[model samples]
Target: MTAMPTRGAGERLWIGTFLVLGSLTAFGPLAIDLYLPAMPDLARVLGTSDSLAQLTISTCLVGLAVGQLVAGPLSDRVGRRWPLLIGVILFTITSVLCALSTSIWVLLVLRLLQGLCGAAGVVIARAIVRDMFEGHRTAKAFSHLMLITGVAPIVAPLLGGQILRFTDWRGLFVGLGAISVLILLGCVLVLRETHPPHLRQRGGAAGTFLSLRGLLADPVFRGYLIIGGLQSASLFTYISMSSFVLRQEYGVSPQGFSLVFAVNAVGLVLGSQVNGALVSRFGPERLLTVQLVMMCVAAAGVVGAALADAGLVVLLVPLWIVMVGMGGMGANTTALALIPYGHAAGSASALIGTSQFLVGAAVAPLASLVGTDSRVMGATIALATVLSLVALWRVHHARRTTPAHSEPLTTTT
Candidate 1:
């Protein structure tokens, strides 16, 4: 593996820039987590089954995935600011519409649109980081962003649960719309165009397809994508099921579930911060290997606890460990994947985000099938962990076996 040259001191990100970017990174999480507490109530209010209500989440995940595929390359071609502006505006509109929805089907459609537009913030934030940073610095920046993104999972759910005491689920969408408005103002004021006109890809749709094809050809990138997608599957399994499992099975209240959710989110915060601190010294690949192993072990423990029908304490312990491992590895895999694609950072970031949510969309429902018992969710997560390990192994193997003339596995010193 070759070492990438360190970025110059002059290229340092300003505190203001970091905050605006962090806000952008929080869009997807805010949209997803804020409404989680309302999902059961949503089912009853909308006159639908729990499984059908969960489909609302899956639909949003699909929208996030598909939206990134569109927004990323479009941003690369049209520049980041305009696409982002349009996305947030549309997202706000969709969120408002979602609040007005009385039917579960209508809500599902609106949520999909909301995810599609909100995806601009999620994908473009990473593209901007890749635009300015490289190697370990990129990873570190992402970890820092996770400080805010991780907080969304913590604060959004707790806030939602609290809000439920006063208003219903519709209020959550209204809140999301209001939040998007603030993010839009931040983008309009703080974010400058990162991709210069001279650097833009000019081949149009044909060119975008070609660029995607080129990225897909890289073994390292593919491996990292698989690793990321599967890791997300593990986490989304938890996210999509935790509300029901804790509330129905363990007889916990919405507020109690929110506290549990927040505690696990803290694991993400701690993991990301630790990864940021250690990534420069240990390198991303090494850290990723360790995280994958940790996730596998923790996921196995989750399965064990589930099978034993152990107490919530036993279950949460290993579940939190899995979240921590996911937090630590998420940045590393993304940074590693995008290292060689700086020229097409938007498209690359899009693919990474898409892979994650797409896999998440697929797994959410499967986990929902057996989520009442926790056994199926645990087994599903365990399977994802194993696949992630296999993906990481392929990344390592590809680095060793690729031709001398091919792109070398590189990291910033």
Candidate 2:
């Protein structure tokens, strides 16, 4: 068998490559989660309504979705390193601009720009992984990436809340700016061009569109994309509603709320680590099937607890289960989706990332519409999980009926 390409010469270089790529992947999560504790303060300080403050988040999501669509094909046409570096530079500049904004409108605009720039890292990081590894190794690399990326949510809110104790909302953006600068330095020092000129897509716009259409037409890609998007919506539903539910309704303090968020994040981290160990044995498809079933059961438990007006423990336990299931399923589905499209990994990664964020953006606002009680949040999650189950079943059925020679390429072996 042919060997997978290595990013550097030794184990140390491999570890460094993973850390840099993982940090790049963490950019979006850090951007979203780090200032969540300050959302109320931001609304008050900027003289904006709660919905408008929340719009900042939704707008950022929109930018993230759109930015990936642009950057993905650009990376395919050009190369990964330049797109990544330029994105990091833009992210740093916009973070500083976001810190300096005097009006909510200004902040919203800057947040959109920040998200746009931040997306280059998120999409390109996945493509870089694809360039360097294939098959089961790709799945394994993603699990490690998840471990690194998962730390953002686990620590960001906690750190942000503590920062709020010493400073205001503006300081949060300043910190984000500083983090971006550090990431930029790391990228400059360590990141190499993974996508080569010989392999790059030619003919620019026409070629890009053709590649995108082909990916969309693939049944396997469609199945994984739908599954990923729906699963992500479940998490975003909780994210959009959790602060209000825990802090406003349940009377938890911001610090306490951060701790609650961290607990669930720990479940995600554990799940990713477990999946990493088990994926080589069971294969990503089998693992994803089991995780989806668990997700449905967990969603049901959440709905039942919410309907009963149960205590926080009942709500949190099921929510943690849902998080764990999502954490395990996300990397597997993404790896499966991109494995067959190695030549267009950037575009494939972009589509997956964009769908996940767009679904998240749409689902997040529904929490407020349905009323931000536990039941509404739980029901939103249940709905997403139900959709995910249907998608999973369709993929399973399609695989069963397809001829062995016609099966999509997977890195299971």
- Using TM-score as the measure, the top candidate is 2
Model 2 residue runs over 4 Å out of place are 1-13, 40-47, 165-167, 247-256, 400-405, 408-413
Q: On a 0 to 1 TM-score scale, where does candidate 2 land against the true structure?
A: 0.91
Candidate 2 minimal-lDDT segment of 10 residues: 4-13
**Residue pairs with backbone atoms closer than 3 Å in model 1 (clashes):** none
RMSD of each: 4.1, 3.2
Where in model 1 is the C-alpha error above 4 Å? 1-12, 37-55, 101-106, 163-170, 244-256, 308-312, 370-372, 404-413
Candidate 2 structure lDDT: 0.84
Write candidate 2's Cα lDDT for 109-161 as tens digits. Answer: 99999899999999999998888877766777788888888888767877888
Model 1 gets an lDDT of 0.84
Which whole-number lDDT from 0 to 100 does residue 122 have in model 1?
A: 88
Which digits, one per residue and each the tens of the lDDT, describe model 1 over residues 1-413? Answer: 21212234325567877888898888877888898889998999999999988888778877888999899999889888789889999999999999899898898888899889989988998888888786788888888888898887777877888888889999888888898888889888777777777678989999999999988888888999998889888778787788777898888997798788888989998999999999888878788889989989999999999889898999999999988988889989999888778788899999999988888777776667654468888898899889888887787778888763154433555
